[model samples]
Target: MSLISLLIALGAERHLSSPIWQFNFYYQHYLRLFNRISWINSSKSSASDNDGETATSSVIANTLFIAIPVVACYLIIEALDNSLLYLIVSTLVLIVCFGCIQTRNCYKQYLLAAFRGEPTTCELHHLQLLQDKNLMDMGFGQSLVWLNYRYFIAIMIFFVLFGAPGALAYRLLTKITEQNNTAVESDDIGSDLNKDVAADIQRSELPHAHNQAISVFSQKILFWLDWLPVRAVAFCYMLVGHFSKAMPVWLDDVFNIEKLPHVLLVDVAEASEDFMIEQGDCTAEPCLLVRLAKRTLLLCLAVIALLILTGVLS
Candidate 1:
């Protein structure tokens, strides 16, 4: 099921280059609706609570709201046979349906608006939201790992268990867990710091080293998970971005700690296009090479999964 889902997703990517309307009509719409429900529930819980309890209750309510759909999806997938076929067919159908729902004139208007560099309200809102968050200067390798984890690791595992629908369920679970943990940690620290200046002062002394340790720990985990996927994703990004950049910087950062690989790559790439240029520099050619590389990796993963699946079945 997992392999099937991956195959379908990969195929979809090749066929549907810009399925933004499909994504919006199905996935994005549902996510936004769920977020609204979570927000409202949290607000109601907060309103009912006293001063200190409000924060905790709000967090709990939001977490519950986020979890419901994930659990429901998982149960549904587990209860069904041939779930992989169902997932792949349903996903494709939904995408096609969404694409059909958009009039030809609407798509043309969207293209024209995109060409004019006119931002949608959603884009504007997203940009504004990013302004409030702290942007980490995670090295290119680290950034790639994060993306792969979010896009591939979690989804792949869940899909293998049930199918693509299960992948969606896993993503929701992962998102909710991550959000809740972050919120709780932030709240605890914020509350403690608010109460005790002396304690905060003492804790601040080793903040740099503490943060570095956490970064190293995270990078180590990412490196292990991203051992194969990093190369696959980097190639994809290179194809998408049309940059003839080698991931030497990313590889170096993953292998060694001292070098600021991300910054160096950007600097070198800007200075000279020849710096990272390989033979056969055409976009389609490079994309073909990347696709080939990704397919090879996927083949390796498939073999491993087959062994495991065989053992389980036996």
Candidate 2:
């Protein structure tokens, strides 16, 4: 079921951009309903009554928000066990969680503009991609690589280990953190962002402190959650890319937890493939990194299929 769903989701992500596949419709609906609940409103009011939210409330709210959907998904899948409907519903969820059409479109447009020698238009699409995911801190190639890990690799690992609910949980947490990160500068986050967000929330200087604290709580959880998967991604880069060049960097940071996930990923990726080149070169750095990411994805899927065949995975 895992391998089947993976193949379906990946194929749909690549070939289909239809409105029916858009995840935002359901996502926004859930947000709207969740926000209108009486207790949710009361919780928010109390958290702001003191002009700040306690770490406890933020943790509870964030945990509940993710936990509710995850628990519900698990229940639904369990109830539909061993049926064709199970596969269909699970694949639909996975498809929605897998990729962003807008990001891909922006990248393609940027490349087109670059080839046409339109620097201004290239910059426009580049900014759109960065702003969409709060990835402005890195180079264009680096951002592309990071988004691949976020949208596909990380979600894939979680789904394989814990099924569709795991994927949904990771996606929801990512959405929270991504939105929080839009207003946060890289300098403000340093290497550790959780502490920084917590401090800012306590001071109540930042608008939306209640929401920011909730997001920061979720961010801390993501840091721990990303610990192993980020390293796994780096190991994949070593295999599918320049193994000799990527090995040391992977080994060095493989156990290091303080570095930002995207930073570590981009570092190994940048080393795995040489991105430095003269202007008007045939292959752009983003193109190379994106290709490396694709190879890594294929390699991962192959490994999963092999595991299923070997009776190591069910």
TM-score of 1: 0.43
The most accurate candidate by TM-score is: 2
How do the residues 33-105 of candidate 1 rate in per-residue lDDT, one tens digit apiece? 5545545545544544445454444445445654565566556556667855566554553233221112222
For model 2, how does the per-residue alpha-carbon lDDT over 1-314 read when each residue is reduced to its tens digit?
88899889888877766645655445544655565567866766677676546556667767887799899999999999576898898898999888877678778888888888887787777776678676646777788898899899888888888899999999988877776555432321233543444444344323467666766787778889988888888888888989999888888888887988888888898888866778765338789999999998888888878987788887
On a 0 to 1 TM-score scale, where does candidate 2 land against the true structure?
A: 0.87
Tell me the TM-score of each prediction against the true structure: 0.43, 0.87
Residue-level error in angstroms, candidate 1, position 27: 4.7
* Model 2 regions lying over 4 Å from their true place: 52-55, 181-206, 280-283
Worst 10 residues of 1 by lDDT: 180-189
Q: In model 1, which runs have C-alpha deviations exceeding 4 angstroms?
A: 17-27, 35-51, 78-135, 162-166, 173-300
